[model samples]
Target: MALDTLDLGVLAAIVLAIVIYFTKGSLWGKSDGEDVSVPRGSSRDLVEILAANNKKALVLFASQTGTAEDYSHKFAKEFQSRFSIPTMCGDLADYDYENLNEIFTSIDGFQLVVFFTATYGEGEPPDNAVEFFDYLENECDDLSNLKFSCFGLGNSTYEFYNAMGKKTVSTLTEKGATLVGELGLGDDGRGTMDEDYMAWKDGLFDILKDQLSLEEHELVYEPQIKIEESVLTIDSPEVSLGEPDDKYINPSQEEAQSLNEGPFDHTHPYLAPITVSRELFNSDSRHCIHAEFDISDSNLKYTTGDHLAIWPSNSNEHVFKFLDILGLSEKKDVVIDIKSLDPTVHPHVISPSTYEAVVRHYLEISGPVSRQFVGSVAQFAPTEQAKAHASKLGKDKALFHEEVTSRYLNIADLLHVLSDGVKWTSIPFAFIIESVAHLQPRYYSISSSSLSEKQAIHVTAVVEQEKYPNVDHIVTGVATNLLFNIQLAQNKVSNVKPVVTYDLAGPRQKFAPFKLPVHVRRSTFKLPSNPATPIICIGPGTGVAPFRGFIRERVAQTANDISVGKTLLFFGCRNSSEDFLYKDEFVDYSKKLGEKFELVTAFSRETAEKVYVQHKMLERAKEISELLNDGAFFYVCGDAARMARDVQNVLIRIMMSERKVTESIATDMVKNLRVLNRYQEDVW
Candidate 1:
């Protein structure tokens, strides 16, 4: 899922995590030529624009990444197009809450005010929405006349599901705003965000017709943007071609200057050298990489439990497929500029570059295609049969799921299937840019303790590969495969070419010598402040990354003669010899800590029946309950969907059986532990 609209402001500090319970990758490229100039409407405030345009509807978005912003824009566009309601999309950061009460009086009352917000980490609003959130919480009052509706984007896996959206609706109601419809919550964890959004909009529209006298107009395909060929040639140095920043456009002059630059962030990542690279798992087929990055010269610092974000480029194979399907492969080097014809519609990818850059660096051409996006492209289909198929697939939910989503078919793949190798030249490149999500950076938990290696950060990533049933090609995780390629290159490993290869040299060899652009991200998942605090960790497969750091820190502390409490780690894998990561290291640590450090293993393949971490936790129910009572900081890191939930259930069962508490009481106890920071999770 993409970040909220607020991501533009706070994206740098934010980490795009890929918690490999043996899993994932994403991107956010910042070419030096990337748009830095202020947007056109910067001078005029939201209220002023609303009044000037006579816009009755205002959709305010507080997006952590860009998903909320995208939804807000879509809503604004739909409202304007369908009901002829002048709607304007506004970022929460761009408006002042002090004058929010004037919306009713200043513009003869707003017909509608919609909020599209995403709840970020720990139930907090995105950084850009923080001021607005604060203002609503403390200062804002008396919105009795203001009519509104809300749609919240959230992952159900997180404890604070839809917190931001729920709080917004609550606060608005408290201030006496008339809620037009039920507060909509889109759960990304369940992959029902689109369905939830569509359903909510239906309810919202019905209410709008009765309240605001809105009448639906004929829905037609509207082009939100214009595309044109630029005079700039492919050989032009100014053209962006997957370059990180403008510094890379002319590296000779900027390289030295960049070296002396003070700050390096998401826009400008420090190219850290890999000091060591090796396979964690013993198996050849299923491999996990353990790599240590040298951040000594990057002026980057991180404590234990922090994350390291890696910005990755799209695979050439995927890029080529996208370009080829679009019939832009031959003219990929031809420069083009994309401009938004509608002010409400913004082009996600900055233009005035070759088609290659747009396909390779900007667009998310690898992910599953959205039905809405496919529907939009249907009108541009080359053949009548293709057009009919596309329309049916888009309109029919079941057909779409069966033919597209279930098949793991991306835009290019779907197009190929529909046209049978025919290129979609009729489709506008501008629309492609508008439809696709921006490439986001992938993050991994720093597996090395800062105390053990202050100047270095280690990451353990399992190369994700899964064969889709009935599909000819295997599904490969983008970032993990890239890392695997890098690992293979670094260790000089032979055979088994990875699914995709990367341009390791990185824009004129700027990132040579095994360098990866990365930055540190702070996390709440931390060990107890006291060294003597007992910790129970349940991490199966590559989820052991952070736990490795935790144990290493303790090992170093123990070596320094510091007293450490019992650290019981419940780890699971397919087999002990196959995918057991850091096995030798854990053995060595146990020898140092004696019974203070206990390593519990669950190898499913080793036995006739499958065993997992949850089973192990339940088996040691009494010991686990006793440790919890003794104030042990219980930690679980792995797959959020299944593993985390299962482990939590196991812990609750332990509490119920051993502590002789009811199920509800046990659940509350677990919740309380989370509230007290005694139950920490670093799941994906």
Candidate 2:
């Protein structure tokens, strides 16, 4: 069966296609000699890496937004410093876990593995941990010699809180792994994540001391990374002044154009132009921005229900204040090169970068100060009184919360208050880099349908501003206010000043004219594949974001003469005239869809009694029950703390009343819907 010339050509073409698909056409690209790939640590074999390094303990993290990773590094650092046991910190995604037993048996001594995992959307393991979870569940069988501990980071408001961390412990135990201590769960919902982590660390240390016959050393600060002040100016091509990667720093014209091209992801973001920016609400005190990004040129794609990750920069005010407090005001523009001293530790910021760039773009400079961090910084205090105050705040939880946490004081704010405007020149810049969490991108539910717009991504964000009773300073949201400022700049809104000033022009004025660094994140919260499947969307306030996409999606389908579903949206706001979002747009949708579309309004402040979406949902209980019976998809988006819960409860009540079922049975029915993916939520 010798192949003909045409058959041979076809075979060659197929092979070429396969190569192109796998390599994303990089196989036939121009040679630059430089590796564009991210620096993942050497070696994927966990046991081999540990054995080579002579590390008795391995701390692995599965992080979504760097929190879990940060905790793992912190744990590894402390474990080594206190127990004198060399520990290696690794990303779970980087290491292979097939030889789990070898870590204990093949290693020099009884090796220990510690997991710090954050549970992502709906009890799912984060993107990086998926393969590990699959292996643990289906492939892995034995781990008799394994000893492990786990600490989970999560928001208590979610139903499946700390699910991945708990899963790790349970699965490992089932496979004969011995658990060292109780699984630790850090709750962000209660604002006790830091405190919870601290408590867990102390308890874990106590257990390790007894079990391993380890001697505790004084927990002195040791910098994992070396930061040296470089002679390079900000204008130097080698210096990184807020650019995400090497490719973004002073690229050629062709390279600049390529930045907007795919594959846009978490590592690579597209510099999207702001096509539209306007305020949604008419209220004076509060504001909601409805901004649209033009992805026409960029190859970035999205669906009806997805998230847009907006990379933001710290405000000029915050950055300057932080530099001033740290006594790095004059040296802010001076370039500094950062190199990791330990093999396991990776510097978060790109080097060589300026102090201003690190503060503005790399580190989270405007979040609540950590209690443990306060105690750590006490030694670096400018005065004895400041040191004592810091020590007291660190030791006493109540006082720390009262003075720092409740006041929404950041690192600089806390330092200023602690020393009464004295500069803390003793604190090492490397310590600052190690202590603070890396600045993370904020995600918003995209408000436009890809089917309708195709090339545009819409974001509906409510600018968060909270004025506490005792605190004179208002706590402003980092990302939302940034978006608001961008909106103001784009629209040329005069006479009204921005709440916070940002370097919107970006590095080297690359992002000049209104632009933002954005990437799309796919979500499971999607519309049904069948166009005729009815949907009940309860989204109060800005939670209505995805539902708007849902409605517009159905409208788009209708334009194609497709049999559109009976779309129902329950929206609640403070007042109908003031904060009713997308009011006119919904009316236009209603006109287009006619009897198929329904907009249920719940204006809380309009009446004597404050009414919400749940109350409105209850009013349409019979309709909801019928829709459920007819295989309608149920969706809820908004505050996970209360609104989502209330809506779920209301749904259960609707089922119980309409179907004459018991409360338990109704609850089970709702749970079943969730399991079947008929019910979904996009809440924060």
Candidate 3:
């Protein structure tokens, strides 16, 4: 119950999951619960469940937001096809772990594959995988015959980077499971994660040969399903998309009852109508917009700490670059049919959609192209000369990264430089789908309370549009620009505005037919269950999103019953006069809450030097410590890499200096916030 890896049944489940992960595709898709929820006495089936010779490769995903699940499916697809391994995918919660050793002892002829697994929230395994990890660490069993490999994905910025994967691998090895290779570490801290993986893949292959005495086989690109006369589409057309129709928007009684889970997700999306939009910038630096999407038809619900994913398309300019480089801008056979031998995360490229859709929607071709992507498809050149050229470019990373990614060149642009209009056949369709995070929604923190606005959500997004240090004319964010443009469009259409000029047939037609698809995700960061809890908040710039909602809820509660605790907000900005957002509104909140509310402002650019939110926290350390001692809930919402961590350090110092406690004890005092549910962070 305390989340230690000590249960016998839990240990059994972890072994089974590690062993049977690759078989997710072969068994589960048959609509059989038979292969799932490992039964109490099925020891033999559990072992066979992991063996790949005749069984499915289990793909057990420990995911926070489905990214791991998606990547695991893609790996499962390639693993099954490349090695003739069958895959079975499952969520960690599916198995009860009541009998895990049966799984541990039976992994002799099996292959174990893990993807993007690690725990958040103080190194506890992801919410769903908690029990499994605990069981594996605490349980006892031998798995010497086990053949396994691991791919650990985590950001290096965290304290316990990939600790879950590292701990699991060590625990399994201690129990006699023979690991097939060196652990694969995928660090997103630096931008070179993809490159780092390519190196890891090569080393993993070498280790696999030495451990299994396996000979290298020609890994041909084979799809699970064969397409005959199939169009060049990547995904199924009938799957579901497009704006809601008249029948789709407002549902009948029965339909409403059936709409508990929204059709909109990473795989499928509901394109809602835009109800409002507006631009927030006056100069050419960048644009920020406030826009809302109507989701009445879908059952998507969200709390204040959630994020929204938006799907966007490549600008026509980038599309042309891809077309020109591939020399397919004029060809008619530029179609693709994707097939997976295993269950794919969501075969992002399997479209009846067309080659254009694959390039524009399925792939991030317009963004920076890693040298590994270029190397992977290099042999598929249309001509021998081009193949040689591509090979050289791949080996010479400096030249490639500089001329291509640095120049903002896409895949198509690179292909054109290597080839002279010839065609090659060695490239695989699986690489594109397997290589990336899906082109889905980018999340923004909710700036409004659902209690106050009910159906409406507010997000204060700052557009990131600027040129890089070396690159010219670069765009900052895809979703931000999309939102900003939508805002401008709405303002022009409104009859109340006076000084507005927006041409429907002007230069912004690349996003000509723009509609938004949105979905919500839940978060555990919530307000205190009791309204009488005192709160201390620090929100600098747009980081103020959640604090606004927190204050609103408190203000509303006070208005209703006249019972509440003190509220203090530490707000920071560049200038008090130029762009101090929510300055006027703080006065209103203070008046409503009377002496119970306080607002502290810090202007980073008030003078030649700059000051930020963390400085303000130190300035009020005495008050902050006193409030914490009085059981006040503290919330931090801002940049995760620096500001959040800096503020944390400041809080620790306050506890140390003012309370006269040793560093270690002060650290625990801060950690106690998480344990007592008094401290929370919504930083990404």
Best by lDDT: 2
lDDT of 1 at 210: 83
TM-score of 2: 0.93
Please report the TM-score between candidate 1 and the true structure.
0.88
Assess every candidate by TM-score.
Answer: 0.88, 0.93, 0.77
Tens-place lDDT per residue, model 1, 151-225, is: 999989887899999999999899988888899999999998887888898789988888777888865556566
Which candidate do you rate higher for TM-score, 1 or 3? Answer: 1
TM-score of 3: 0.77
lDDT of 3 by residue, 17-73 (tens): 875665544344421123333322233343444443244346566766555565565
**1-684 in candidate 2: lDDT tens per residue?**
999999999999999989877765446431122122222366788776776656789898888877898888878887887778888888788878889877888877755889999999898888889999999999999988899999999988888888888899999999999999889999988878889999998998899889877789977887777788987899999788898667798789999889877798778788888889999999777899999999999889999899999988899989999999999999999999887666556787998899999999989999888898898899999999999999999899999888888888999999999999999999999999988888888999999999998999999999987787998888888889988898888888886776678999988887788888899999999999999999999999999999999999989999999998798889999998899999999889989999999999999998999999999999999999999999999999999888888899999999999999999999999999999999999999
Sort order, TM-score high to low:
2, 1, 3
lDDT of 3 at 379: 56
Runs in model 2 with CA error above 4 Å?
1-40, 252-254
Q: What is the alpha-carbon lDDT of model 3 when measured against the actual structure? A: 0.61
Better of 2 and 3 by lDDT: 2
Error of 3 at 164 (Å): 3.2
lDDT of 2: 0.88
